[model samples]
Target: MFAEEQNPTTAVAGRRLSDQQAVAQFRQVVSRVEPVAERFCKQETADRENFDCDIQIVVDTSMEGRNAYQTYNDAGKPVVGFTIPMIADARNPDELAFVLGHEMGHHIGQHSHKQQQQAVAGALILGALTAYGQASATAANPYRYTGNDQRDMQNSIELGAGVGQMAYSQTYELESDVIGTAITKAAGYDPVKGARFFARPEGKRTANGRLSFWGTHPPDEKRLATVLATIEGIEVSGGISRR
Candidate 1:
């Protein structure tokens, strides 16, 4: 996030660019990434009827944090949103490119839908177990089957669903990193330096193990390593040279 008094100049392609200049560069990055998204959709969804790559980029000035996310609109089209603070926080065009590519990776990988499916499956299993446990309890003591007991059972099922959703969140985050590295490289950006954004103190600070196993994202260190390895592998294979 950026404070109101923060400097307006940002680094872009090793040169300082004002906020307006940076925004223009960000738009150019979006333009380059759009074709990459289209190519991915063509390769991944050619068999499906009426499937087309539709990605919309939204800049929300009202947002408070340095964050970006991918989601589907009401029409099922993928949307990537960047907060003003996030844009302001980006030190260079490559940082913005990597962030945009990362969000695109989420859509390209269909992580949103896949994660929902995982959560639903987990919730169903948990709900079944809770039902079985409640039935067993009621069978052992018929007098225990009261309104409060039913409410508690419902609460347990909800809690199980929440836990289930979190269980796979970290997995999806890692997967996104892999895909995002490729996407950033394909867009002709230096994913390695872009990845260094995660190595910064603020980025490292966010990876605390408070939730550990239940965290929504893996530790920043792990993510940084994955990005480094992925980019190295790609280079070794002569995929794309570092920009």
Candidate 2:
């Protein structure tokens, strides 16, 4: 939803929650999900000491996007930022919880660090290949210069980096969905209902084969299916006690 057109007061849990109220609700959800995040950290990471399993939620009212994301703060701590529009768009606490869980999943999965490593590796490999090709071309004919070799090499490296970044982008998104489902369930919310937020009309339209391969996120339908399957598995294992 567009930030300019969104209502400042939105409904959450069948009642009107202003922006301030929404922020409070977000904090409450985060507090509930912290134990789940800690459990994931213990299970996934070996260096638990350096990993700041504590998650801090920041409500950015000045932000434009109807989205939330996870990143490291200046203090090297995991922080999730919820844009005002995203908060305004949520229909209930469960939706907010799902979004928060997804962002936390990115951190839990160490996707940011992994993606950066992949991009750097891809750039180094591709840059070397480009330089080798340039040298070979120059050796074949010193005067057969196509254009600026430096510029061409830079372009190739950038392209390779982009490809590397997108290589596992869809996979990361799907993995986040799975983790987020588990999180929502563990937090005593209905993961199935939380997944419905992605099945909204706007989400469906955006996922309709628009740059399917290049986009960072998987299609909403695919995400919904993964969430459903994950929730089913969790239920079978009695992983989460429904509230």
Candidate 3:
């Protein structure tokens, strides 16, 4: 989707790629994102005594065709894992870099850890309320947390757990784009050219959209607009926010 010299640092995930090809794409993506990730987190990573994270990329078909995501190991090392699904066919390196950057942004912004903590806290608070009510007035159960209630609770926690966490995630996406733009540019890629695939056409939707309360990603237009603005700003200012 991009000229190598023109836009060298796009995320590369395509359909039905071989294992070796996928690894090659991943290495290229890491090479693109590493510098941006470092620029995004230099102050702490540069300080050996105060290092906050170590990022590792794990590629496995066993992930059953998932896109890139951030997971935290017990030691709290941030692990970005990707499945074969994101890239449906053979894709260029730029496509891979964007996905790689998105996953990196999850760690860079600390959203994964914060969301994990928020979900747990929300559930615990609700559980305590359920328990206290059960003991108080001989109320069989105030929280009939099953079936739809369970589903609704889950959705609420995911979508409405904390103030603007969802919005913050959206913002981080823009941040990642800016970082990705710079990183890709340095790695010899055009960030905007790579971002075209992310645009959602009218009437078309992802399967995840079929869910009742799928609140993970911003609507495509919203995400695209934000990313475009970030890229434009970077093109004009040359990486102002990170500093």
Candidate 4:
């Protein structure tokens, strides 16, 4: 049912999570999914970092837009934090687990810094291209030019970056979903119920046709389809198993 990719793997940048509200919610997510994710983290990263594989929930004031993420300082300390609105606004426990798992998935893939670095690099490259294009275009059509061309060029670069990022980022998201489902299940919740969490992306599906859910995330159908597959693999109650 999904259009692109689906599976819990890794993620790009996450929302800041160092605030009181964010901290409480992140702690709740940690309490629920750490058991399962911990093992995955150790396995994924070979326990090479100082993290000891225990996901720590913290608050971040610099975040906005219901985000969660893993961070590493220049000193090589790794931290995993989730945002408040992300968990608080979740439709159910599964969604919360999905967010937490996705963030943890970034750590699992050892891509926390790489993703952010790429995004920043993409922005810089786009900016430089925009300036160069503007200068060259000015020589060609100086009098007819509006700043919109630069904006459009920058937009295209960002758009391309976004698509490329999702191509890879979605892989991580799907991987995290799978891993998150297992963790949420192990935490004693029905992952099927948590699958509703995937619905949050639907709100962004305003356009129709081929571009639906293109810029924001992997298509909803793809996400739900993967989650359903995950649910099938787990030991649930009746049709939906509980851990």
lDDT of 4 by residue, 81-193 (tens): 54455555554445566666756666666554556666666766766778787878788987965759856876867865664454457666676666666666767766656
**Cα lDDT of model 1 overall?**
0.68
Best candidate, lDDT: 2
TM-score of each: 0.79, 0.81, 0.63, 0.56
What stretches of model 1 exceed 4 Å from their correct place? 1-18, 47-50, 203-219, 238-243
After superposing candidate 2, which stretches have Cα over 4 Å from the reference?
A: 1-16, 46-49, 201-218, 238-243
Candidate 3 structure quality by residue, lDDT tens digits, 132-224: 544564456656544464455555555445633443566666666555555566566655656654542212334555321113433355445
Local accuracy by lDDT, each model = 0.68, 0.73, 0.58, 0.59
Candidate 1, residue 161: Cα displacement in angstroms equals 1.6
Backbone clashes, each candidate: 0, 0, 21, 24
- The candidates, ranked best first by TM-score, are 2, 1, 3, 4
How much lDDT does candidate 3 score? 0.58
Q: Per-residue lDDT of 174-235 in model 1, one digit per residue for the tens?
A: 66677778778888888766765544434222344233111333335667777877888777
Model 2 C-alpha lDDT per residue in residues 143-195, reported as the tens digit of each score: 98678998999999998898888788878888888888888888887766666
Among the numbered candidates, top TM-score falls to 2
How much does candidate 2 score in TM-score? 0.81
